[model samples]
Target: MIINGVSVGPYQLGWRLQELEEKISISGFVEEELDKHYTITTNTLKFWVEKEQGEITQITVFGEYEGKFLGKIGVGNRLSDLNDLDIKWIKEDYVYKLPDYPGICFELEDIDDWDELLAPIEFISIYCS
Candidate 1:
């Protein structure tokens, strides 16, 4: 998905906060000082800004962009939703990590106490180190 004209991907690693603001218009952010980070939340996505080097390191898409979510998966989609993608996923409990795609992770939320049923996606995180 595209955030402020820059797509949410590894290429966003070196993007400055102002540059992003220029593109998406920074309304406000929850400032985090420990690591010079900031979280900008929009109606559709959450941007995690890392300022150690004055750049954005990660982005979490909360819902569909335009008409697709991660190429078909949406916020409430379950693990089975990813069946169409030709990705080899590594599962650890409810979290799925893609080995082929660095800085990308999908987490499922266990709404019920039972873990037998498929869980809906809580969030999708894309990072750049």
Candidate 2:
């Protein structure tokens, strides 16, 4: 999977909900709605999409996703793996973000142990900066 600030794999931020549905259909993936977001599930990946006015505003990847963000960071990577970057924690969401990189954030398995080197990432969220 190729991930950038604006996109995850082929799913780009700001894509229309209909466009995403078409791609999901072509890939034979299943989609489900939960609360305010929609989830797309494939055999090895699960991602959530939140939209506004029919356009995707955020894309969050979790649950067995095997791809890396920017081919470097990923769900299983430890918190220490990001030590070289300027990472900030968002208390309200229990997620971390890099000040230099907009539109992306990471959720760890244990937010309380966020400073622990072994804390593993649980989710990767991409959105509009």
Candidate 3:
């Protein structure tokens, strides 16, 4: 089957919708990226993210399938799957909402890695605020 993303296509939205295993997960290829992203409704691009300030990264979730709830989990599933299940966003404050077509994305923040741990600790604190 073909795969489609906010960026990738072929299957586009239709094929992606089929990947839903009653659950779906969005994981970052790198630790510095937004680790978690999920939607509460169809056509809803808003997603909640797991943020890392220090050496940590990503805000993620694991969703499961339930016929009645029509909910989707992140565990044991891939971002490429969506057909069999509806996105069930875990309720949170940092809900990621997309403002543009395809979706609103983040501009990765730049940082300098220091040999000392203090730099990371201080950086994480700033984000926590």
Candidate 4:
């Protein structure tokens, strides 16, 4: 999917972090840990980038913006909403996993005392490594 006009995924492996910052308007900072990480954020969306040896190792996204994740079906939506789009999802634990897109998932949030037949997305995650 596209984030700020830059395509991201396993294909984006090896892309430089500077390239993303220049291409996208999102704001973030690099953090030091076992591996270096850059976190980009909008009001509701967060993009995580991991680098090892100065090259991108993985990218992940999380948020609820415009009822989509990276412009694909995810977040800010109910589980039933995807039915209209004819997308397949698997519920495991509290996350809805998309089989069509590997390494992509949406976490569910409880809005009421009891779990509704339809659940709202709390966040979406796209893992690329």
Candidate 5:
């Protein structure tokens, strides 16, 4: 299913996962003293495509098992951090434009805890001509 122009499920563009336990640690919801859980995830991919009127498409993916913690999060977070390591400007044809390049964006569980550590994450939006 598609929600807010973002895709869902295995074929979607977004995901959240943790290979090891206690890595993407999440507290506050585990007051019940839960033990363990399983999670899988992917990064955010926002790119532009010819949608008849220059529409932007974004995709996100995430999944996890439930164990009664933090009210249940679809996917565990590695400290709720995101990264945009390698990025480059996207060209419509042969020219580059402002606001049309890849940018770093962070999706934090709590904006209050978001800091420089999350700088690696970002979002890329298309600039209007």
Candidate 6:
């Protein structure tokens, strides 16, 4: 998977829900509609799409997703891994965002130890700002 500021793989922000359904079908994944969003799942990946006015506003990926964020970061990567990039992460609750990449956030594993550099990323989210 390829995740950027605006998209996760082929799932771009602002895409219609119908477009997602078609892509999901073509990818051979299963989609389940929750009260507020749709969950897409496969053997190795799980993600959710939240839509407003029929267009996707957010995409979150978690649970064994074996893809990199911007082809560099992903689950299992420690917070320290971003140090070389000189990113000043904006911390909010348990989520961290690169100052320059406002549309993407990484959720770390331990909420109680949010500042631990060794903390591995648990998931990633992309959204429209």
lDDT of 5 by residue, 42-91 (tens): 23322232223323233332223222112222233222221222222233
- Per-residue C-alpha lDDT of model 6 across residues 31-126, encoded as one tens digit per residue: 788888777776544555664466777677777777787677888887788886666687888678887777888888876756668878887887
Number of the top-ranking candidate, with TM-score as the measure:
6
TM-score of each: 0.71, 0.73, 0.17, 0.60, 0.21, 0.77
Candidate 1, 23-103: lDDT as tens digits: 666445444454568876766667777757767777776655332344565567666666646656788676677676566
Off by more than 4 A, model 2 = 2-4, 26-52, 84-93, 111-115
Task: Output the worst ten-in-a-row residue range by lDDT, candidate 6.
Answer: 43-52
> Distance from true position, residue 58, model 2, in Å?
0.8
Q: Order of all candidates by lDDT, from best down to worst?
A: 6, 2, 1, 4, 5, 3
Q: Which ranges in model 3 have alpha carbons more than 4 Å from their true place?
A: 1-7, 16-98, 102-104, 107-110, 113-129
Better of 3 and 4 by TM-score: 4
Ranking by TM-score: 6, 2, 1, 4, 5, 3
Candidate 1 residues lying further than 4 Å off, grouped into runs, are 2-6, 9-11, 26-34, 63-70, 84-86, 92-94
Residue-wise lDDT of candidate 4 within 17-123, one digit each (tens)? 67656645545444444436666555554555665545454444445344444355555577677777777889888777777656666777777765533767777
Model 5, global lDDT: 0.27
Question: Which digits, one per residue and each the tens of the lDDT, describe model 3 over residues 1-129?
Answer: 111122111112222222431223342122123434322221212123232312211212222211111133222332223223443222123222222212211111123663221111110000111
Model 4 poorest ten-residue lDDT run? 2-11
**Roughly what TM-score does model 5 have, to 2 decimal places?**
0.21
lDDT of 2 by residue, 1-129 (tens): 635467888888777767887877856778788787787776644556674456677777877777787577887887677765545444335677766667788877866745656778887888778
Tell me the deviation in Å of residue 113 in model 3: 7.6
